[model samples]
Target: MEKLLQGLIQFKETDFQEHRQLFEELGNSQSPHTLFIGCSDSRLVPNLITGTLPGELFVIRNIANIVPPYRNIEEYLATTSAIEYAVNILGIQHIVVCGHSNCGGCKSLYASEKEMQSIPHTRKWLELAGNVKEKITAMNIPESEMAKREWMTEQINIVEQLKHLLSYPFIKERVLNQTLTIEGWYYIIETGEVFRYNRHNSEFELVN
Candidate 1:
């Protein structure tokens, strides 16, 4: 907590002063171009990874970076509200769902219900990733290769979230009209490599 306070002071003294104009413009209104949906992993800093400034990307972070399929948002509004605002109000042109290499949420997909009993809310939230497990299981991957299974789950989860995003009527309409674009991104936290899903090839390729 003290470290965070010190960082805040440093930002006010150095970084904030250096970018005073940028902050001033942002103070009035923000017009970010991309909506970045990524894991709430401390290691995955979207701005640093994308080389973006404060007003460049509007970001939403969640426990596995899961995008629950569009539904009537009466109860769960955390991620959904952000998505709606980023699209409807902010007019973001690109939506990128990024999943990382070693994610605790993705790791929990393999945990038994009893094992996840303690973290009920987390378990419930991760239920949105059920299809990721189902699809990977259908692939019949070797049971001995646990690491490979986890990696595959992480990548498949990104694609699954992309499908979820398309389930939104507004998002789909915008995508169809070429007003918005969606991307499934995989980030290697260990190697700092990024891969983006190529719809044409139906595979994730290095993001150059």
Candidate 2:
């Protein structure tokens, strides 16, 4: 807490002042080009990873970086509203759903109900990745290789959420008209490397 406070002070005294003009310009309004949906992992800082400046990317973070299938406004209001506003109001051209290696949320999918009883909301939220679990489980990977399975599931979750994003009618329309593009990203926390899904190759390739 103290560190964060000191960082805030430093930002105010140094970084903020260094970019005073840019901050002033962004004070009134922001026109970001992309909407980044990433996991709520401390190591996977979207701005730091993408090297984006303030107001460059509108970000939304959630457990496992899941994007639920579109529902009525009253449902999942926080995430849904951010999506609506980013695409419709902000006119964001690109949407990126980024998943990281060894994500606890994705790993928790394999946890028994007894282990998750303390986190009811989390257990419920993880239900959004049910499809990923089903698809992975069908592969019949051995329990001995749980580590490999976990990593695969993390990447698969990114693709799954990308599909969920299309469930939004507005998002679908924009995509069909080439007005908006959606991409899946995988980040390796250990190596600080990023990979992007290549639909053409049906595999994730290192992002240069």
Computed on alpha carbons, the lDDT of every model, listed in order, comes to 0.94, 0.94
Alpha carbon lDDT at 65, candidate 2: 98
User: What stretches of model 1 exceed 4 Å from their correct place?
Assistant: none
TM-score of each: 0.97, 0.97
Alpha carbon lDDT at 204, candidate 2? 91
Candidates in order: C-alpha RMSD to true structure = 1.1, 1.0
lDDT of 1 by residue, 1-208 (tens): 9999999999999999999999998998999999999999999999999999999999999999999888895695989989999999999999999999989999998899899989999999998999899998898988798888988999999999999999999999999999999999999988999999998988999977
User: What root-mean-square deviation over C-alphas does model 1 reach?
Assistant: 1.1
Candidate 1's TM-score = 0.97
